[model samples]
Target: MTAIPSAMRVIDVPKPGGPDALTLAERPVPAFGDDDVLIRVAAAGLNRADVLQRRGAYPSPPGAPPNPGLEAAGTVAAAGRNVREFKVGDRVCALLQGGGYSEYVAVNVGQVLPIPGSLDFIEAASLPETYFTVWSNLYEFGRLQRGETLLVHGGSSGIGISAIQLAKALGSTVFTTVGTDDKASFCEQLGATRAINYKTQDFVAEIAALTANKGVNVVLDMVGGSYVARNLQVLATEGRLVMIATQGGAKGEIDVLRIMQQRLVVTGSTLRTRAVEFKREMKQRLLQHVWPLIADGTLRPVVDKVFDLADAPAAHAHMESSTHKGKIILKVGG
Candidate 1:
């Protein structure tokens, strides 16, 4: 093994505030436990969760670092005695609870996966948080199946793009909502059957028209609040509505009678707080099912832009602008 550095630089959230609150600091490299592996991070993926963490709306899980990153890709620096899946020098990407915004992070072995030969560090870094979340919610929880119809909100966002591609690749017809014409075009190019521009059209009406008034089988939602009732209205019988985030707002009103009448199922989840065992199971499923598609070029990660580690604040600002088409990344190391 190469000599590990005693200290490394990390982006820290000094307090709950805006993007400028993110600042750089030096800290000791994290140590791995019996089931953990220490990774020398090359790049980190940015997510809306990180924005919430920076603003104090989302808190890190117990034992996670104060830093706000949720996924990273890099080479393994060391492995704990009990870790057998990965060893030093292996290239891997990880789903992290926190601390990915640093030069090195200690991750549980089960939450890590080998980087596919076709993907570079930045692209691999973009996979874990979005892929895991999309798979867990869209298939595991939402129960999306082949020939089913799915409506995905935020078509140009990382999770949205992942959902669109995965659903299409799995033989489902997908409809999505985007903020602009460019984003709509991007979503269609990525295989969305239709991309509704939310600013110019009502998604519920669009879905109703597109599905010929029969409605869709599942709705993958990130914008909650006002969308809850509308989402409920656009579901077919026994349809599933899976909520991953409440980007619009947390509170919403829904019709219980309508839910009962339509036999609709409303469910949601957050990935970071899930148990290691659950993530391990997800990792296994991805390796068996999704990794092959990624490896063979049937599916690919869409990167809108990348920023240097020291420019994390700019990255956050760009994300908040909501203008980027896909995943935003931070290059942390070579």
Candidate 2:
């Protein structure tokens, strides 16, 4: 058996600020509980949430490490006494509550899954955070149905790509907004029916034209601020607006009369703060419904770039630039 190390290096934000605020620090390897497993991380996904946490806008949940990471993939180095689904030497990826930016992470079995198909650790690491979010917010909580039309803001984003592919594969039409024509083209190729260039084109007008003024069934918006009012404009009567992030700004004025008349539903959630049992259920659903799609090549992770563990600052900068499409990953052990 391979000997377990007592210490590990982790990316830490001793003081939250810009990308440069992130630093490498040494810490003792996390200990596992009865239902937990110790995973030797190969790669970790870099997310907008991590960026937010780095900026001091979002903090790690209570009981979670202050380091900023939400998902990782590698081999299970040790399984606890109550963990039967995984064992030492199993290849797996996990959705974490925080602290995935390390050589090892201790996570409950409920938040973990075997790596799907022939994917490498980098690809597996890219899956958990966004997939868990989209599946939960867009499908389950949003109650988006097949045959519905979805309007996704930030089409080139990780969440956008995942939502687009999922909606398209599940028999729905997808319209998305992107900043550049290149991003628009990329999204269209990835299955978005119409990728509106928000810089040149007014999304509200474009969506109205595209849907013939009927608007869409659901709008997955990350840009809150004024976009909220505009999103409500593009939503059809009884349309649902599911917000996952507020990159634009949080406060906004909405038309309550329009909401009452149209019966629009406004809702949002933060996946990092959800219960483990809920995540476990989402994990099972991913295994049952989404894993086959990945295995069969119907749906796949779109990794934009990979940075070494020591170069996390650069990775965060790249993500902040928002020029890349799909997921950004931090290569750890591998």
In order, what is each prediction's RMSD in angstroms?
A: 0.7, 0.8
Error of 1 at 225 (Å): 0.5
Model 1 regions lying over 4 Å from their true place = none
Candidate 2 per-residue C-alpha lDDT over 1-334 given as tens digits, one digit per residue, 9 for 90 to 100: 6888999999999998999999999999999999999999999999899999998989999999889899999999999999999889999999999999999999989999999999999999989988899888888877888998999999899899999999899889999999999999999999999999999999999999999999999999999999999999999999999998899999877999989999999999888888999999999989998888987889999999999999999999999998999999999995
Candidate 1: tens digits of C-alpha lDDT, residues 1-334:
7799999999999888999999999999987899999999999999999999999989898899879899999999999999988889999999999999999999999999999867999999999999899999998999999999999999999999999999999999999999999999999999999999999999989999999999999999999999999999999999999999998899889999999999999999989999999999999989988989999988899999999999999999999999899899999999
Position 57, candidate 1: lDDT: 87
C-alpha-based local distance difference test score of model 1: 0.95
Q: Which candidate number has the best lDDT?
A: 1
Q: Model 2: what TM-score?
A: 0.99
